[model samples]
Target: MSESTPSTGASSPLHVAVGILTQGGKVFITRRFPDSHQGGKWEFPGGKIEPGEDTLSALKRELREELGIEVQDARAYMQVRHAYQDRDVLLDVWRISRYQGTPHGREGQEAKWFACVELPQLEFPEADQPILRRLWLPPLYLISDSRRFGKDGFLAPLERALKAGARLVQLREPHMPLDEFEEYARLIAGLCHRHGAHLLLNAEPESVSRCNADGVHLNGKRLTQYSSRPLDDHFWVAASCHSAEELRQAERLGADFAVLSPVAPTSSHPGAATLGWEAFSRLCATANLPVYALGGMRVQDLARAHQAGAQGLAMVSQIWGANSIERAVTALASS
Candidate 1:
C-alpha cells in the first residue's frame, strides 16, 4: 500500500453521539475518560442512540443528562462509519445551536470551549466531523476553474458565469504568476460580489485585502497548518479537505466551508482512486461543515453529494468543461 493512501476495508457497526457547542463562533468539546473507548481523546459530548430513539431526540436527551443543559432546534449534520481493530461502528451526528442552561459535565467528563478556528489543538473524536464542516462555511459553491486566463480572459467569462447564476467562485490559479494572478483575482472577486455571489480566494491572504472577496480558500496544506483567527473579520475562510480528519479540522478552524475532493477521480487525477459511494457517505456523514466534493467530479455528482449530507458540489473542469457557462449553471442548478 502507498503511504498516505487510505485503506479500503469493511466498516463496523457501532452507534455514537456527538454535540457541537457553538457560542460566539466557538465550539465546546469534552475530553474523554481515560478508561473509555478511544479514551483521553477530545470530542463533542454525545453518546449512542437507543434502538427506538430518534437521533435528534437521543442527542437532546444525552446532552441534558451529560451536560445539564436543555437542547432545542437540532438538525441532522452528517453520518460516519469507522472500522477499528476492536470495534467498528456508525455514528449519526447533529448540530444544535439553540440551547438553554449553563453546561457543566454531570457525567464527570472534562469540558472546555475552543474557538472554532483553533480546534486543531484539541483532541477531537473522528465521529463529530461532518457536523463541523457544515457549521464552518457558506453553502458550497460549484464554479469554473480554468487555467487559460490572461489579458483576454476573466472579466468576460466571469460576467457570463454570474449572469448564468454561478454564485460561489474560487480564484485558484496554480500556474499563474503572482502579480498576474492577483490582478485577475481582484477583477473577478468584484464581479462576483456585484452579482451577489460569494467570492473565495484560493489561499492568498495577503492579496485578499486588495480584493472584494467574501472569504479565503485554504488548500489541504494550509488547512493542516494554519489557524484562521488572525485574518480580517470582513473576510471568511474556507478549506479543502480530503479525509475525515481534515474535515474535522476544517470545522475547528472556523472555516466557512470546505471542498472535499475526488468523489470520483477526474481527468486531472486519473490515476487517483475514487472513494466509493458508501465510504464517501460515511466520511461525509461525520463532518459538520457544508462540504463540496472536488477532484474529477461532474455535475451528475451533485445529487450524490447532497444525499450524503453535503450542502452541494464544487467543481473545476466540469464548470469550465461545458461549451457554455449557461449549460453548466443550468445543469448544476437543476441538480
Candidate 2:
C-alpha cells in the first residue's frame, strides 16, 4: 500500500533504519501485514530506531527481534527523506554486507531473497524507489566523445574501456549524421552486450529499439517535455539535470538516475557557472534518485563525487584521448 496524503498537521518525520541483507547477489525482503501500515507492500526489513538507541544498535536489535539473525557486518548505503501527506520519513538505509544466520520473519511477514535486477518487479513503498535506483546505478557513468574521437577514433578505445570494465556508457553524438549514428548504435550495442555493459543512446526513444540499445538518456530539454517516464519499465531511462528542481522533475518523471551538471568547471562549456562541491552536495541532498556529478569530472574525482552524495561521476573529455581510457578503467576498480 502507498502512503496516504494528510488532511493537516505539523509533520514530524519518523527516522527508521532498514537493512538490505544480502546473500550471494540477492537481498532479503519481507512483506508487510495486509492490515498494517503500508499493508501488503514488500520492503527491506527494519523498524524505527527507538529513543536512546543509535542506528547500528537499533538495526541489530530490529533484526534480532524481527528476523532472528545477528548482524555480522553492515554499512550505511544511502539516506532518504520522503513525505506522505500525513507524515514525513527519514530512511537510514544500510547494506548488510554480512550476517550470521538464515533469515526468517519472526513477525509473521513473508520473507524472500531477490536479486537486485528482480527488485523492480516487486511492490514496495514509494520511498524505496530511490533505494532501487541507487542499487541499479553503477559507480562510474561514461559519455562518448565521438565528436573529438571522430569516425572510427572512439570505437576502439570504447571497446577497450568496456573490456576493462566500463559498465554504463552513453553514446552522445550530436554532430554525427542520423544514419551514421544509428549504424554506430547497432555496433555499439553489440559491443556493450558482449561486454555485459549497458548502452544508452543520447538520442530519441525510437532510436533505442532500432539499435538494441538499453535505453535513452534525455537531454535537459527532452527531460522537461516528458510528463512521465518516456519509455516502458524494461528500458532504463536517465536524464541530465542542472538544478535541484530539474533533479526533482527527473525523480517525478521516474528517471532511473540522473546526471546533475556543471559540478565543476569544464571545457565542455568554458566559463559556465559551476556548482562547487558545497553547492553540489546541497543539491544532491534533496535528491531521491541516484545523481552523478557531471562537468569537468575524471576518474580521480570518483571518491570526491561519492563523498558529495553523488552515485558517481560522469565524464566525456576526461574519458577520451590517448591514455585517458585506461585511466578511466583503472578508476572503476578503485571507485
Candidate 3:
C-alpha cells in the first residue's frame, strides 16, 4: 500500500480506511449496494475514524461492524489523505492478520477475497487501484531462458504469478515462432496492464509494437546499437549487461533498467559459469541504473539482491499453472 505523499502541497479532508489482507495474500473487501454512495462498488473494508479513535482501534471497530470479524493484528501500512467531491478522506491502510469470525455482509452487502490480478475484474472503487499495484510487486526477479519448464509455455504460468504479486516481468521468448509469440505477448500485456505490472520485451521491437507491451529488453548486440532516442514513450527500454563496461554502455543509451545475470547457476543453465553473490553485489552496487539478478533465481533471493543494491527480481515459469496465486504472490513479495 502506498501513502498519498503528495509531491506538491494540497490540503483535503481527512478520512481513514483499513484493508484486511488475509492468509495466502487474499485481500478481504466489501461490495456496495446499488443506489448507495458510490454504490455497487467494491473496496477494502474499514470506515471513517472518529476524532478520538486511534487507527488500530478504529479499524477493529470497522471490521467488526462491517464484516462481523474480530481483528487480531492491525498495523498501518501507509496514510493516504485524498480529497473527494463531498469531503476529504485520510486513508490508513493496514494489513490484518488474524480474525476471530468469518466475514459476512452486514448491511445487505457482500464480502470476498481475491488475488491481485483478479481484483480488477471485480467492481472495486476506482480509488483502490494504487493498493492493487503494491499487491502485484514481487521481491525477486528471475531472468529466464524461454521454455525452461518443458514447452507448455510461459504465458499462462506467468499470468498466475503476476496475479500472485509479481510486479515486474521480462519477455525473452527466444526460439518461439514470432507469429505465435505475438499472441502470447498480447495476452501477457493485457494481464500486466490490468494488474499495473511492468513488462520488458527482449529487443524484438516488432513484438513490442504488435503486442503493445510495456517496453523493450535489449541484448548485448541491441544495447550497443542504441543511440538514446527511444521508439516509444510507453515502452521502457532495459538491457542485459554482463560487466561494468556493458553496464556503462547501457546507461549511456538511456536504458530504463538492466539485468545482470549469472548471479547463480542452476538446473536451467547447467553449462554456464555463475557469478557468486559477492561479485553480483559488487556489480550491482557500482551500476548507475537499476539492476536485477538474472541467472537462476528463486523468490528467496530478493532480500540478498536488495541488500546488494538491486531493484527487484524477475522470473519465468514459477508463476504458471498455480492453484493458489495468492500464496505464490505473497511468497514472492515477502521473500
Candidate 4:
C-alpha cells in the first residue's frame, strides 16, 4: 500500500522510501490495499520515512515489514516529487539487486513478479510513470561519432555494439548536411529496428519523423529554442543539459530524459569545464527526470555515475574507440 499519510495540511511533501526489487529479469511488485492511498493500483513496495532515519534505513525497515525480505544489495536509483490534489510526495527510490529472502506480501497485499516488458500493462500511481521510463531505458546510451569514423565505417561498430547488447543508441552527426543526415538516419533507423534496438537522431526535431527514427536528441542550443515539447508523447525527446537550469527546462518541455555532459574532461573537449561527480550529484538531485552522465565516460565509470544519481552513462569514445566493441558492450550489459 502507498505510504502517503493523511494530509496534515503541511506544505512539505511526504517522503517515502520505495524499493524496486529485481531478479532474473523480472521485478517484484505488490498491489496496494483497496482501502489505502492510491488503492488497488500496482506499486513498487515501500513505506514512509520517519524522522531522524536515513533513506536506506527506512527502505530496509519498510521491505521487512511489508514484503518479508531483507535487502542485501541496493543502491539509490532516482528521486521523484509528485503532487496530487490533497498531498505531495517525494519518492526516494532504490534498486535492490540482491536480498536474503523471497518477497511475499506480509501486509496481506497481493504480490507478484513481472517481466519489465509487462509493466506497462499495469495501473500505477502517476508518480510511478517516471520510474517506469527509467526501467525501460538501457544502462548504456551509445552516441554515434560518425564524423570520426566516417559514415561508412560507423555501421560496422554500431552493428557490433547492437549484437553485443546495446539496446539504446543516438546517431549524433551534427555537422552533416540536412539532406545527407536524413538519408543516413533512415538507414541507421532501419538497422536499429532490425536488431531490436531503439535509435534517437541527434538532429532537428523534424528529422526524427522524416527519418523514421525513434526519437530526437536536442543539443543545448536546440533545447533552449523549444517553448514546448518538440514531439508528441509517442516519440522520445532527450536533451543535452549542462546545468540545473537546462534540466529544469527539459523537464518543463516534457522531455523523457536528458544527458548531462562533461562529467569529466574528454579528449574531444580537453579544455572545456567538467562537472565532476560531486556537482553532478547536486544537479541530479534537483532534476525531475532521469539523467545520463556523458563526456569522458567509459564502461568503468558506470558505478560512479550511478553513485552520483545518473540513470546511466552516455558514451562516445569509450564505445566507438574500444579495441573490442563486443567486450565493452558485454561488460556494460553485465554491469
Candidate 5:
C-alpha cells in the first residue's frame, strides 16, 4: 500500500454498493460507458445505495435494475473507501451467493463473466485493483513461526507447504538479525515465486524490494504510525490488527487485507483475551478489506472463519511440518 493521494476537500464520501455475482467458476463484470466516469473500464455490476437502503437491500435492488437479476442470497465481502479525483466513494462490495434469472446488460452496458484469475489483465478503476488482488488469495495464510523450527529448519516445511498449494506466506522472524532475516527472506521469496505463492515480509517494508518479496506485513504499531501504504499498487500490503479500530485503520491506509489476532486462546500467549468467533465476525463486518482470523487458528478452523466473515486463517505453529503443511494446504484448496 502506498501513501494515499490526499483528496482536495473534506466532503462526505458517497456510498455505493457493488456485487460480484458468480456462477460455476466465473464472476460477472460490466464495462463502463466510454463517456462516463472511469470510462471504458471494467467493473463488477452494481450501483449506488440509496439514502435509506442497507447494503444487502441496495445490492439486491441494484442487481435487478442494472442486470435484470434477482439476488436470492448474497454475502458482504469487502468494503472499500477510495478517493478519486472527482469524489470520495465508499464501495460496499458483496459476493452474490445465489441469484435467479439470466443476466444481461439492461442499461446498454456490456456484461461478461470471467474466470477470477483472468480479471487482472482487464482494465479496472484504481479503487477496484485491491478487490481484484483480494480475490487471488487462498483460504490459509501461513506465517512462519520459527520458534520451534530454527531458521534453517523452517525452509523445508515451507517448501512443502508451497508445493502443496499454500498460496500466501509471511516470513515473520522478528527475533532474527537483519542479515540473517534478509537471507532467509530472499530464499523464501524464491521458493514462493517458483511455486506461484505470494510472500510477505513481516514488518519490513524496506526489505520487500531487497528480498524480492511480494509485500510487507505491518505490526500493530507500524499500522498505527503509517497513514498510507509504504509500497505502490504492485505490492500487497497487510497489517496485524487487534481490534476493530485497527482493522478500520488498515483499510484507511489502503491495506489489501488484515490478520485479526487472538481469535481464540493461544499457547504462546496463554490467558490473553480472545475475540472468539462472534466478536471476530463483528469486527470483520466493519472492514472493507479481507480479514484473516489469526492467533490460535488452524486449518480445521477455515470454514468457521469464512462463516464468521474472514477470508481465511493465519496460523503459525500449525503450518510448520511437512505432513501438516501439505494437509493444511490440501484442506485449504479443497475448502
Candidate 6:
C-alpha cells in the first residue's frame, strides 16, 4: 500500500518495502484508508520499513502483519523515488510469487485481485506509475538487427518472435537512412500490431509518431541530447544506458524504461568494457526505471538477469542469429 501520510517525522525520505503478489496472472492490491496518504487510491500491498531492517525483512513483516501471509518467495523488482509537498518516499518493490496463507486485508481495507490490463483504469499513487509499467512489460526485449538480415529476411524471424509471445520489440537499424527507416518502421508497426505487440523505433523521437510506432528507443548519445522527455506520456520513451549517470538521466527525462548494456562480452563491441553481473546489479539497484540487460544476452540468461535486478533481457544476436527463429522464440518465451 502507499505510505501513510507522513507525520512531522524525520526529514529523510521514508523507505517503504512494497510487494506485488500475483497468482493466475492477477495481482493483489489494496485501497488506502480515506484519511491516509493517497487516500482512496489503489496500491500494491506493503508498508514502511523500520529502523535496522532490510527490505526483504521489512516486506515479510509487513505482509504478515497486514495480510496474514508469510512470503515464501520474492525477488527484487524495481525501486521508485517520489516526492510530495510534505515528504519524500523510496518504494522498494518486490515480486512475490510464492506465499503461505491466502491474502485478505487484515487492516480493514478494501482489497482485491486485478488482471494487469485492468490496472491502468484504477487510481494509484503517483509513485506507483512505474511499478504498473514494470508489471505490464514483457520479460524479453527483442532488438531488430535488420542490417545483418536485410528487410526481406527480417520479417520471417520477427513474425516468429511475435507469434511466440514476444510482445515488445525495438526496430534498431542505425545505418538505414531516416526516410528508409521510417518506411520500414511503419511496415513493422503494422505487423507488430497485428500480433498484439508493440514496436519501438530507434530513430528520432518525432519519427515514432510519424511511423505510427508505439514508442522510441534512444541510443546513449541521443539520450544525453534531450534535456527533457521528447515525447508525451502516451508514447513510451526508452533509453540505452551504460552507466549509472545515464540511468539517472533516463529517469530524470521520464523514460519508461532503459537497456543497460555489456553485462557480458559481445562480438559487436568486443573491446568495450563489460559491466558483468556484479556491476550490472550495482547499477540496477540505483536505477529508478525498469532496466533490461543487454549485450551478449541469450534466452538462458533471463533468470540470471532477473537475479541481477534486471527487469528482463534485451537481445540482438541471440534472437536474430538463431538457426531456428521459432525455437529461439519458444525458448525465450518459456524462460
> Which structure among the candidates has the greatest lDDT?
4
Give the per-residue lDDT digits (tens) of candidate 5, residues 177-224.
999999989988998999988999985699999999999999987888
Report lDDT per candidate. 0.69, 0.82, 0.68, 0.88, 0.84, 0.88
lDDT of 3 by residue, 178-244 (tens): 8777776777678787876776677566678778786788888887876773554335677888898
Q: Rank the candidates by lDDT, best first.
A: 4, 6, 5, 2, 1, 3
Q: For each candidate, how many residue pairs have backbone atoms clashing (under 3 Å)? A: 30, 1, 13, 0, 2, 1
Q: Tens digits of per-residue lDDT for model 1 on 70-166? A: 9977776656565555666566767787899887877888887777657745565554443444444433375545554554564677677678777
Candidate 4: clashing pairs of residues:
none
lDDT: worst 10-residue window of model 6: 1-10
> How does model 1 score by TM-score?
0.59
- Please tell me which model should have the higher TM-score, number 4 or number 5: 5
Residues 203-298 of candidate 6 have per-residue lDDT tens digits of: 789899899998899998899899988987567889999999999999989898999988899999888889999999999988877899999998
| Candidate closer to the true structure by lDDT (higher is better), 1 or 6 | 6
Best by TM-score: 5
By TM-score, the better pick of 2 and 6 is 6
* Candidate 3 vs. true structure, TM-score: 0.54
lDDT score, candidate 3, position 278: 95
* Stretches of model 5 off by over 4 angstroms after superposition: 1-16, 33-40, 48-62, 72-76, 83-89, 107-109
The alpha-carbon deviation from the true structure for residue 312 of candidate 4, after best TM-score superposition, in angstroms, is 1.7
Query: Which regions in candidate 1 have their CA more than 4 angstroms from the true location?
Result: 1-140, 143-146, 149-151, 228-233
| 2 or 5, greater by lDDT | 5
- C-alpha TM-score for every candidate: 0.59, 0.71, 0.54, 0.72, 0.82, 0.75
Candidate 3 regions with alpha-carbon error over 4 angstroms: 1-138, 142-155, 317-326
* Angstrom error at residue 62, model 1: 18
Give the CA lDDT, 0 to 100, for residue 188 in model 4: 93
